[model samples]
Target: MLKQKAGTRSPDLTVVEMRRALAQRIKLLAEKPGEHPTAIPGLSLYHRTTPTPCFRASYEPGLSIFVQGRKRILLGGTEYLCDDSSFLLSSIDVPAQSQILEASEKTPLLSIFLRLDLPTVREVLSRDDIPESPPSTHRQGLVAGETTVGLIGAVMRMLELLDTPEDIPFLGALAHREILYRILRTPQAERLRAIATSGDLGQRTARAISWLRENYAKPLHMEDLASTARMGVSTLHHQFRALTAMSPLQYQKQLRLQTARQRMLMDGLDATTAAYEVGYESVSQFSREYSRFFGLPPIRDVKALKNSNTALVSVA
Candidate 1:
């Protein structure tokens, strides 16, 4: 967690004011419940008017700042609570179940999501003035921390740029760098640093994860994955689980299940078709696993999702 500097005055009042200001901006930009992509590259706003059921989703490498309300994210067996005062940082792509815990029509859940730029992170790490943190034995890909005033201010400036289209081409890059630099100053910097540093085991593990994400449909061979990460099979398994909270096989199963759900939901594919498309050889096996993961059969789950979306649209 990021701590306030020594001898510095408490920033409670300033944080509250800035949070309210940021929430107003998000309300103006979002205008409805859902993820809203901004003109600025890699920046997105999220607003939710009501609490939601736990839903499966994939999070990429990014910073998620919760400016209002509350959310719950379940990664593996661990649960993370993100409220107005918290931020969730993901250093690698991982699957999780998330739900909105607090939101209402009067005060919706508001947040910001920004994809991390690897090049910029590496550039910041190259600086000599930055202090180094000792290596952690338990490397986790997803972490939660308290939101700092400096981080909130930087995000507010990023949102301000949306009102000036011309400034985005120039000032946008500066804002991105500033946000990263602010994060790097915090203890959470080690997570980003581990992945950005070349020749690091974390970086190698990230390579293997990237491969899994892109080629989930392909048959997964431990040897191939080990070769991709340039580590022995056992070492790769240990490092992979340490970072992702799941083994390679478990991770691939999640990817397949999630993609299959998407195909069925968006493309009107049937269970059998979607199953085969996502590398599941047997439709029955896919149905069994899908039921276990999502708490409903494939057909029923898709129907529920479609109905929920339709209701949301009608309400809007």
Candidate 2:
């Protein structure tokens, strides 16, 4: 159960009640254990009936609200523990490992994930009425915070819109704006704002990350990447590590490996073929790295994943 503060407030509902309502709605929509995309674009609901093993996945820029159960995310050496009251904000694309820690058939893990619309975030930031918070010294891409009643209410309304199909095209945009506005009002908004603001180092580093993600199969050149972000090589390296919790080369390797795993599982590609397809020149080197990262060789890992009934949940 979600632990409530002594005097948490809401206009017509307590925080815990609001969370329960949201969870019930999500449970109704997501009847099975997997990601369920809704009519609203960029919004997805997740349900897991049992605790899962740690799985490597990539998280894009988004806001994830947990209404039930608990999860843990590992970014580099840092571990973030999230429960019913927690919200995770990802300011950029990142690779990480995640596991569902507290879940059961009676009380399954439930969450609402909304992919951040950069244009809407920028629009919300442009408003003069939004309260200003202190700038964050360390601009990490993924941060977790406690959820508030107001934020939960906005998310609940977003889910409520699914019942009315015609209202989505018009009200959905407004809902998106309001959700972003609520997030910007929080102290955690600084990292998000820095990334959305033009010419900011955070945004520049984000551009470099985007480039790396798009061209993961290609050979990486530090000078070219630095030039793409319009920053000096050393500065780009500093800011890139500051935001992603890993060096650029490490990030690229993760992308390459994850994509290769997906292809081998989903496309039936052999280990040698998958390695070469994902820019690995030597199959032996790819197999060694894959084993080290995934704790199993390519064939064994893919076979295990294929036999398992659980799907990898990527929203963190």
Candidate 3:
């Protein structure tokens, strides 16, 4: 049997070896930009040679693990930091920024992100000795836990598939499955596991979230959304906030404003048109909400995005 770790007993026998191998994998993947789709899709990984000061921005739901550095995330006015021994898990969609606290010119900030997918989590979770974590109120935008060796090992194997295209369609799936499985068995795997199997208020809230993203610009009705989530309107309202740290309407508003901002920046759409396209009945309302969420009016924000060159760029 694999020796149990000091604080946590990870079931995988090769946890330590796996972490060392994963260190190498992160180094290799960091060699080039866009080299890690097998691990994280839709993110443009950046290498930082300098330690960054505190900052905050919206963090999408995902796993962010650094191989050579440490960082901190600021959310709801709280700061959380993690190093090589730790990994960050963002369960729900959040708008927060993170700062790199540790980096070196020689080592830089080496990291890899695996964008979490709900459907994928569901599939892998159905297969193992996974246990349900007791539900909690007031979900966190982010949490940190000691990185398990098995999790690291699974990540390394997933990256290895990049060198061989033939292994992807078949072996790649298993690698992906194993990665999730390892996460299920980790110390704080409960948060992610909750994401996969909870049929409670949180899960219902997540379903309502899917509706918001899929139809951001549509006219939103609480009753309709509740029905879609298979919950009553009052229950939906309470549960959505309990899970996402924001109200349902607020959630929809964020989705609309972000997409509208993107349209203006990328497609060069005029502010009025962008507002209408993203489902604002009145341009005035769009401008008001856009400024509230993004800290700038549509035209100025678009200009800023263009000037920055890195502003609101798409994963593509």
Q: Each model's TM-score, in the order given?
A: 0.92, 0.94, 0.79
**Once model 2 is optimally superposed onto the true structure by TM-score, how far is the C-alpha of residue 228 displaced, in angstroms?**
0.5
Could you tell me the lDDT of residue 128 within candidate 1? 92
Candidate with top TM-score is: 2
lDDT of each: 0.84, 0.87, 0.67
- Please give the lDDT score for candidate 2: 0.87
Question: Candidate 3 deviates by what RMSD?
Answer: 5.7
Candidate 1 global CA lDDT score: 0.84
Q: Pairing residues by index, what is the TM-score of model 1?
A: 0.92
The candidate scoring highest on lDDT is 2
Clashing pairs in 3: 56-97, 57-96, 57-97, 58-95, 58-96
lDDT digits (tens) for residues 1-316 of candidate 2:
2222212333344877888888999999998977899999999999987898999867899999998999988787667788887788899998988899999999999998999999888888888998876877646788887777778889988888999989999999999998888888777889889999888999999999999989999999999999999999999999988888899999999998999999989889999999999999999999999999889999999999999954543883
lDDT by residue (tens digit), candidate 1, 79-151: 7788887778888998877888899999899998999888888888888987896665537787777778898
Candidate 3's residue-wise lDDT over 174-248, tens digit each? 776776777666655666776567685566777788788889889899999999999999988877765555787
**Cα RMSD for predicted model 1:** 4.1
- Candidates arranged by lDDT, highest first: 2, 1, 3
